[model samples]
Target: MSSMKYKSSEEFHDHLLGAIEKKRGYHLKRFEEHKSEQDKGAVDALAWAYTLIKFGKGNIKK
Candidate 1:
């Protein structure tokens, strides 16, 4: 029996696009909210800090 399981590369690409659509709105909202170098840099730094704190394997506790 045949199924809609993305049997080909093109089919897989098209199938997952709708999932990304939901994030598109959030992406644009974030882009509009931060239109300054300092604002963008701060946001980026917060992300980096969060990654270090959460996934740093407790190495950056100092």
Candidate 2:
């Protein structure tokens, strides 16, 4: 939901780092789930959704 747009890898990387920092169960689990995705688009979409959940619609950029 972030207004800030990110490249796919950027989204994934940010979420992964955020997960590490926050240590939220779902965030960490989601990061791992997305990490194993072989399709780039699926991974990107997963990252985008996770970023939205972690950062909200306008609070941060990926």
Candidate 3:
């Protein structure tokens, strides 16, 4: 028996997409806040988040 809330693969993908979008928003805010400080890690995180979002969106379409 699975304890997961999503019962279908599409639902699971949607959940993942929502999670990634939330995290991407966080990373974007962090990058903005630390931009003036030249935070390398923040920039990298933001870039990775964007990449993940793009990949997720692409996968969800198929």
Candidate 4:
């Protein structure tokens, strides 16, 4: 990891994309925990469904 500070929103966004792409398990678990904690029932369910339908067919690379 680089010791670089995000100077702009775009930089932060890109950094987040790279982090999520690299740390799949961490991000997924965090999302699940956050959704449960917040009690975002229907919205979270729909998002999960869309994620499965959108990315379910792709090959996972580690």
Clashing residue pairs in all predictions, respectively, total 0, 0, 0, 0
Pairs of residues at least 3 apart in sequence or in different chains that clash in candidate 2:
none
Full-model lDDT, candidate 3: 0.64
Q: Which candidate is the best by TM-score?
A: 3
In order of appearance, the predictions have TM-scores of: 0.38, 0.29, 0.53, 0.33
Please list the residue runs of candidate 2 whose C-alpha ends up more than 4 Å from where it truly belongs after superposition: 1-38, 57-62
Q: Which ten residues in a row have the lowest lDDT in candidate 1?
A: 53-62
lDDT tens per residue, model 1, 28-52: 4575787666545555665554445
lDDT for each residue of candidate 3 in 1-62, tens digit (9 for 90 to 100): 87677666677767766776676567667668776444546556656865776566646432
Question: Each candidate: what lDDT?
Answer: 0.50, 0.56, 0.64, 0.53
lDDT of 1: 0.50
Candidate closer to the true structure by TM-score (higher is better), 2 or 3: 3
lDDT of 2 by residue, 1-62 (tens): 76655577557567566764454444446657676444444546556666665665345544
The TM-score of predicted model 3 comes to 0.53
3 versus 4: better TM-score goes to: 3
> Each candidate's root-mean-square deviation in Å?
12.3, 11.5, 5.0, 10.4
